[model samples]
Target: MTTKLLIGLDGQSSGDRALSFAENLAKLIGTAELLVVYVIEWSPYSFQTPEENAERHKRREEEISTAMERVVTPALARLEAAGIKAQGMVRHGNVADSLDSIAAKQNASQIIVGRSTETGLSKRIFGSSTANLVMGANVPVTVVN
Candidate 1:
């Protein structure tokens, strides 16, 4: 059976590196499919009142969809041009959880993620999402710096 790869893209340089790494791996394992996912981290305090929060959440979802259109749509087009069948998905939740859910839902054999560029105390103070996925995912996870 062909291996399936899921790549977590955060619109950063590290994310680009992860995509390139996944592409190379895909080439080595022919017939594999690629799924690119972006998670929109949702904040609960987006509004003052419950009704306002609902409205704000709806607006934020639309904004996230628009942002994905700007980034993922073109990126997928480029991938298709390079002869890779690619699909993009957006989810709202904790980054690591969203990635794991996608991987499970797609039955992904492998997951590619980018190591956080943050270092030193910052990395320590603010835990890395990639680190969480590396520890949490059920399938094999490859982290690219």
Candidate 2:
């Protein structure tokens, strides 16, 4: 069976670093497949009127479409160009939960993401989803710096 790596992207430099790391890892594993996912932070716990609900739904669709177009598409193309086996997905939900869910459903051997290195913002103090995933994911988790 081929191994799989579930890579979480946040559309930032950290995510880019994670992708680079995954590319190398895919190389090392040889038969590994990279499953790249970008989770758009979304909250459904808001009160809304009929019109508001319609607008929110439309916005959500736009976000998903944009992410697939702007993020997933390019990443898949690059991986494919490098002769790496890969696929990608975009979802709207809590980042950590969504990534873990995808990993479980895809049977990924490991989950990889980039650690936040923003100056002055401690992930421990702010509670990044990367930290949450490390704490809660069922599979092994890797954080690329």
Candidate 3:
């Protein structure tokens, strides 16, 4: 059976490092398929005007397309160029939950993400995606610095 690895990317330098780490690990594992996932966060509980609610679905699709073009597509191209069998996806949800869902759905053996560089108030308030994944992931998680 082919092994699969799910990677979470946020279009940052740390994300680039995570992709690099996952790529090297995939190479070492042989027969491993990489799935690069870029998540655009959305909160369903937010109050919205009727017009905004009416356009929410369209906005969600646009967001996914934008993420694919701006993030997933380039990452996919690089992975393909490196000769790694790979695929990509754009989803909207909480980061940790989305990654876990994708990993379970794809039967991924591992989940990899980058350590966030955010500090101070943001770090304390929002915590980090890496930490959430480490705490909640069903599979092993690798945090690339």
Candidate 4:
């Protein structure tokens, strides 16, 4: 059976590095396939009126469309060009949780994510998605710089 690698992309240079590392690792593994995933941070706790909920749903659709178009599609094309067997996904959720869920669903053996490019008081206070995933994931997570 072909092993799968889940690559979490942030639509940034950090994501590019993760892809590059996964590409090389996949090349080494020979029969490995990749699933590239981009997660848009979203929360389910917000309370909203009917109209507000409708607008939120619309914005969610827009974000998914934009992520699939601007981030996931290009990554898939790059993998194809590199002759790697791969697919892509765009989802809205907490990044770490979403990635871990997808990893379980897909039966991926490992998850690869680049360290976040952004750093400040917010990141320090809340911790990064990578840190969260590394702490909570069932599958092994590889962090690419």
Candidate 5:
């Protein structure tokens, strides 16, 4: 059976590393399907009134979708160039929860994510999403540095 891989991309340098890692893993494992997911966290403080908030959210969602497309387009192209089967998904929500949900929904054989540089005091003060996902993911998570 071919393995279905779900890779969470955060639009960071580390995410590019994860993509490379996934590509290598796919090559090694053979016949793997890659699902690349990017999450955009929507902030509620971007508007004043409820109506304005809704509009702002809608605009931001579109912007985020476009940004994700821009980011993933090249990655997907690269994967295809490498003869790897892949798809792209852009979601809006908390990174950890969104990743967990996507991985579960996709029935991913493996989940790949990048390790954030936020550690020590910073990590403690503001919990790292990568760390949270590692702990909360239902499937085995492969964290790339």
Candidate 6:
């Protein structure tokens, strides 16, 4: 069976570094497939009017569509052009959980994400997604700096 590597991309410089790392690792491992996922942080716990909730589905669809068009597709094309076997996915949810779920579903051998440069109170309170993924992932997790 071919090994799979799942990468979490945030469309940032750190994310680019992570992708570069994953690409090299995939090439090193030989024939491993690459799956790039962009998760738009979203929460469903907000209170809203019935009308607002009624439009939630539509909004979610639009978000996914935009993410696919703006993020995933371009990344996937770049990887493919570099001759890496790759696929992309766009989801709206908690970043760590979404990446972990996708890795599990795809039977990925490893999960890779960029290390956050943010420090201090905010990161300490909210926690970085890479930290959470390392703590929670079932498979091996790699944080690219």
User: Model 5: which ten-residue window has the lowest total lDDT?
Assistant: 41-50
lDDT for 90 in candidate 2 is 93
Give lDDT tens digits, candidate 5, residues 11-30.
78899999999999999989
Q: What TM-score do all the candidates reach, one by one? A: 0.85, 0.90, 0.94, 0.94, 0.86, 0.91
lDDT of 3: 0.91
Weakest 10 consecutive residues of candidate 1 by summed lDDT = 41-50
TM-score of 2: 0.90
> Can you give the lDDT of residue 73 in candidate 3?
95
Best by lDDT: 4
The sequence of per-residue lDDT tens digits that candidate 1 reaches over residues 1-145 is: 7677998888888888888898878888878889988887765555487687669768877968885897577668767877887889887778888899899989999889888655688469757788888888899999997
Give one digit per residue, the lDDT tens place, for model 4 in 40-143.
98889967799888698788888899999999999999999999999998988899999999999999999999997668986899888889999999999999
Which model, 1 or 6, shows the larger TM-score?
A: 6
Looking at model 4, the pairs that clash are none
What is the RMSD of candidate 3?
A: 1.2
Candidate 2's displacement at residue 1, Å, is 0.6
In order, the Cα lDDT scores of the candidates are 0.82, 0.89, 0.91, 0.94, 0.85, 0.89
Cα deviation at 50, candidate 3, in Å, is: 1.5
Model 4 lDDT on a 0 to 1 scale: 0.94
